[model samples]
Target chain A: MQIPAPFEYVRASSVDNALALLDRHGPESRVVAGGHSLLPMMKLRLARPDWLIDINDLFELDYLLVDTVPNNGRVLRIGAMTRHTTLLESDDIKRLFPIVIDAERVIADPIVRNRGTIGGSLCQADPAEDLSTVCHVLEGVAVVRGPAGERMLSMAEFHRGPYETAVAQNELLIEVRVPIRDDSGSAYEKVERRIGDWAVAAAGASVTLAADGTISHVAVGLTAVGLDRNVTEVEAVLVGQAPTEQLFVEAGRLTSLACDPLADQRGPVDYKRHLADELTRRVLRAACRRAAASISDITI
Target chain B: MQISMTINGTFVTHEVEPRVLLVHFIRDDLRLTGTHWGCDTTNCGTCVVLMDGQPVKSCTVLAAMVDGHTITTVEGLANGATLDPVQQGFMEEHGLQCGFCTPGMMLTARALLDHNPHPEPLQIREAISGQICRCTGYATIVRSIQWAAEHPAGAAPETTTSESTEQEVHA
Candidate 1:
């Protein structure tokens, strides 16, 4: 298939040069990192741009650093341009957070993982994206850079709505800072028709408990199946209650009740709601299992 | 746009459209017709090539993106008279039937084997999933890779995947 339309290809050697090209070209330009998602869209005539400033030469952007915090806090300093493969295969990720890394492995096929950059995916802002929900519970911070220098937005504020974000057109997401939970258990589970398709519904469940398994704090966020992401109802039922199978069931029911599923070909509204509930319960149990285990013994 | 690269161990350059795909650059522009195109979409590896020794789906990349990179096609597998071990293995094992997908299959298999010589059956399957052969199930294809890895006649590059790999560097 031929690449759609005609556009000027500006190969950038540095980030400053890239910024200058975007400044000079104005809205006529779009940045290309890996070109996994954007080029396909262009070929199908979904997103057409007059100019493409290739940032392939900007090798400095790809970095994944783990940062240590005082007593109870831990952080993952992730470069936005790092490929999904790098994250999946990273020893640091396995050490800091295995649950989060396992969730990333089921993203797409290997080639897509090797080429699709983290920043590019987040910038696309698909509602059903898996990483966004992980960010929701992990309470991550997104570092963005642009013509206006650099700024950081919390995960909560960064994702505004479906296919929407607080990021400006001129800005590029530089890095994502993700928090690590020591006592808390975290798990992400997603459902799709087949591999390579976007998620129909994704849920990230995090729960911290007392020494006796009594729930301390809880966060459950669902994406794709819902318009606006709201987890207050589920968290309310989960925080005070002990993380047993029964409580997880209630949380899943509450979360599913909050979703307004649109009737579509994929599944009926009720069917999707049922799936939302089941997936929520399953993922919550998995997360709770991880959380109840000792921090040093966190596996899977 | 003008793009130049080594094709079949010879320096070749040609003017192409900015949107021209690398597979087309290899087949139509440079006339190294050994590289075949099956599925234009990247899901099929029939248009795969050794671009800088990586088995990339040439159909998915723009010729302009790899102007100065070293490239290799099926025609470059042999040295004058002797066929590379992989080529000999394919013929001996009946690794091809219609033969349309063999070139891309061999190139992809070669790229993988060059990186990890003793690949397990599962790994070989993953590498070749991009290439679809209507006939001659991947059993023989995997055997061909295994055979080549076991017996290398110094025809192929010794070890590649970066600065060290290009014994036939032409740009």
Candidate 2:
């Protein structure tokens, strides 16, 4: 019985047209890509915009490509309107960043995945959101375009807070760029109430091993655990250290201490902290295993 | 606002308010009530329909968003008196304790079969995981979909005695 309040609808033919519509409608406008999250919120009266600018026609904003940036090596560029199904099925995403696959598989069930977009997920920015943590661990940057032009914002800057993002009222997130590193592997682990529910507490890890079999670059991010951004202390413990069960145990302990989770229906604060610790260790172990395998793949 | 789309192979147009959800538009405006609306929220897949050959929650989609797309509801599953394999499978396997979740489940199964003609039991469960069947007939539902996969071209529709008796009672 829930329905959105009366609002004017306009479909954008292109990205430029989307921006122009946003400007024309002013602050009372919102761009709906997937409408999975926004429409539900609108129904609940959580988000009641005066105008809805539908950008579903902007097919140009739906892409997943690997671009070789000058002096920056190769990076995966995911368009804003790319559906979750595409990410789950993309061989490029599976091979380059398995973390995305890991997260996408559990983001929603197959039906919802057909319509939900990566850009919509990012813009929704729920605290329990999985992809944000995945992007943070992968060090992804967002390409946001406004009337002034485009700006690249790091994951840390792009995600302002729970249900908040850096995408301005008149701007659109055009693409997400994740640098592909050599000898690196990434993974995400989450525990939800059901098959496609929000995470109770999830963790993502990206690890790059040096020639000496030591961690060279590492990033760990946790979801729904009151952690606003990536855990630097966990990274500090694992960096330059050899990948070992004992080392992972230490990292897990550090992760437990670093996160601050609140008690709710999912679990108590203690249970969430426990999940944060265990999931972090699990991801680190899997990531390091894949990282070593990637090195072997290169040499072989 | 005016919108036009293909629903169940039929071209239709309507002047609906911008806020009208596709589920309501299909049922209330077009009088295609076979697509049940449930939970209002997107959690329940009772409002699922095929959009561009993929199953999407119609309750979450605006009618305006589907202005020029194709949608297939349960009404489209059968042609003339011939039933789709999915529909026959349901009848053969007794897939419904209550028929509320049947349409969405069948649409999802159809889409899954289209992409993967032969999905395993676990795959079938995964495909319909988003939907809720309060009847707790998941075991029978999965069996029904499996039966549909076994009969890809569909089989002759047969009327069971109990169903015929129930129909006569209603009549």
Among all windows of 10 consecutive residues in model 1 chain B, the one with the lowest summed lDDT is B162-171
Displacement of residue B78 (Cα, Å) in model 2 is 0.5
- Per-model TM-score, in order, reads 0.83, 0.95
Candidate 1: give the clashing pairs.
Answer: A185-A291, B45-B130
Pairs of colliding residues, candidate 2 = none
Task: Write one digit per residue (lDDT tens) for candidate 2, span B106-139.
Answer: 9998898888879999999999999999885599
Q: CA lDDT, every prediction?
A: 0.74, 0.91
Give the proportion of true interface contacts each model preserves, from 0 to 1.
0.11, 0.96
lDDT tens digits, residue span A1-300, model 2: 799999999999999999999999999999999998999999999899999999999899899999987645799999999999999999999898999999998997888899999999999999998988998899899999999999989999999999999899999999999999989999999999998999999999999999988999999999999997999998778888889899999989999999999999999999999998999999999999888898864321
**Which stretches in model 1 have alpha-carbon errors above 4 Å?**
A68-73, A207-210, A227-230, A263-265, A292-300, B4-13, B76-95, B99-101, B129-171
In terms of TM-score, the best-performing candidate is 2
RMSD, candidate 2, Å: 4.9
